[model samples]
Target: MTATPGTLVLAGTPIGDLADAPPRLATELASADVVAAEDTRRLHRLTQALGVRPAGRVVSYFEGNETARTPELVEALAGGARVLLVTDAGMPSVSDPGYRLVAAAVERDIKVTAVPGPSAVLTALALSGLPVDRFCFEGFPPRKAGERLSRLKEVAGERRTLVYFEAPHRLDDTLAAMAEVFGPDRRAAVCRELTKTYEEIKRGPLGDLAVWAADGVRGEITVVVEGAPDPTPGDLDAGELVRRVRVREEAGERRKEAIAAVAAQAGLPKREVFDAVVAAKNAAHGAPSEGKGLT
Candidate 1:
């Protein structure tokens, strides 16, 4: 018996416009041996738009079905089925389902690939006018006040731009939490209904944005935040550096990242940062280097 070649295509459909669907996505959908979609109805709508009926089996692989569908999908992939995964918008597994399937495929050494599509991250980042060279995506923060604050505290000193997807109803509370945790002066932009007619970008300090969102805004929302400002050079001091680094490190930042951040803020080289960290470690153990400090 001949073995079939197995492949997993991670396809991207438009977040809005049907015309935005990439050619590869349509072709893959038309020929896939198994189409795993977040929503079968939306998939049908998409197929209708492309005028291409999938000539393969279709399966719903949404949040509710994700856990139950994985083993079955894995078995099919092991049998060399060309499983194509598509979500309702943008890409799958990003604030959606498909991560588990992707993880399973990787565990079994199955090939995985993507068909590029629209993203609220890039769209909001582009429109936010905030620095985007480096960024971190936080997805949606916790809905409850305490949990949300705890989460925000985790990224309080993040120097890279931050992106967040928020719901219309929670906009005010989320923005308020961001202001309190990230500081009222933090620069941020609120992007709503991207790629749609009512698309809007509100840019200002977090305090102002919080107030605006409090009045209630509708449609899809994407938020972009400017990173923490780098402290000026020559502000070196072991005290503040240790405080900042230890705070963030305790909040979940990796040691290496914490050191780098302290280095950036102290206007010190990474080597200097490393030396400071070592000295602090030594001090904690009653071995502070007497020669390392200023003469």
Candidate 2:
């Protein structure tokens, strides 16, 4: 009889509280034939805390070694070994490892599944008090200010609530940059040490949060920012549209691109914005304002 192929199980570990580790997680940890973890040391601690002895051959599987280890893990799976993949916290392949291995397993026709558990992204979003009905998880901003700002600029106009993971040390600067790009008045929440004893959620305008974080915070941090507000018809006036276009231009957007962005934000056509600019220029130059023009 042909033996059934093995399965790849991506289990979610507790983000903080040990009790959050589901019974299925424990069972999977104890029964899998091969267990791969981001940090074997952390895995050992988790197993000890849960009083579970993994009956599998434990191996290290993290970002640095994932590429090299994936093929090996896939081979084990092909040999009918049930492979359990876990990260230090939360679900794997989410800003973590296990994605490459899972992709490899799928290519070989091996079954792949996940054990749902606590997610910091969802946790922060829920507590953020922002609109969670529609949201996007942007895991970790770039460490460098320039790259980070460039990244932020790309999402400045996103209407869906935005979520991001940030290092405590960089929290202040990141918030400040966010305030600069997304606007100081933009509402946001900074959730730190989530699900832990000292868990704290700071909610306020980005500018205020930047000032507060200047003192420094500690622990796993997740930030959720409210989406840009919908533009009302009154906001599309020529002068308002011009100001919006200027804001984009100041952010390094090309004139044409800025006009398009302004038009989208104001719910106006690009031609309308172009005409507004031309008319404003003509009025300033004491030229005809309403005749057939460039736009």
Candidate 3:
């Protein structure tokens, strides 16, 4: 790494309204020694809107060229080039291409930062009406049905709300798989063309949303799903609950949700399942239950 004063700055463009662009973004675009954009034409339009003309070099840094361009951008940073990274919309390196360059810059002891702007992730998340304390962002599920189903299987028992970016074309199938895996009654929201003209937010059970998507919609889409509820032992089938707990544990569910789902299904409280699990363990070790004599 060559000695340089330059830093890598990721600037978020607006997800919709051009006015949502942060003032600092325009300053960065104008002052940087280089601006790497996912789409140079879009960047030009944005720059024009801000009345800021870049005195720096502008290069296309998209998926197809990101791997090849990271090294060169790192070299520029080493030579004191103030490189500004921007995507077509939202932050770079978030299901975007700036991650590789950011990682490389850190490895070289180069400074890295961001010019925070609008994000569809937080925007849709805040509007989701689901638990906000904890959540995960799944960029996009695979386009293929089998692959998407397999991916949904991995997150079946996740307790935190989940967010996903998806193409409008595959929205129907993606939602169908979600309903199948997460249960038809799970709550979710479909946010489309957010912050733009004709913005629409549809909130309902996953099953209903799947049918709506089949009608064919357009524009960018963000999906938010509610987390799984806590478990109750009495809601479970004694034997089935225990078996499900084991199978789910192996498949990646926390001991708690597996137990909870079993309890819920059996119409029992969670404590009962917890006690049963403990008793089963003790029996496996040849230990007699103290309650046996009392009964």
Best-fitting candidate, scored by lDDT: 2
- Model 1, range 82-120, lDDT digits (tens) per residue? 999999888888898989999998998888888888887
lDDT of 3 by residue, 1-295 (tens): 6365589999999999999999999889889999999999999999999999998999999999999999999999988889999999999988888889999999988999999999999999999899899999989999889989878876775678999999999999999999998999999999999999989999999999999999998999999999877644344345545665676788787877877765665567677766676667678789863333111
Enumerate residue pairs that collide in model 2: none
Top-down lDDT ranking:
2, 3, 1
Q: Which residue pairs in model 1 clash with each other?
A: none
| Per-candidate local distance difference test | 0.85, 0.90, 0.87
lDDT of 1 at 39: 92
Q: What range of 10 consecutive residues in model 3 has the weakest lDDT sum?
A: 286-295
Candidate 2 per-residue lDDT over residues 171-243, each given as its tens digit: 9999999999999999999999999999999999999999999998999999999998887755557876776
- TM-scores vs. true structure, each candidate: 0.84, 0.82, 0.81
Superposition error at 115 for model 2 (Å): 0.9
Better of 2 and 3 by TM-score: 2
Q: TM-score: which is higher, 1 or 2? A: 1
State the TM-score for model 3.
0.81
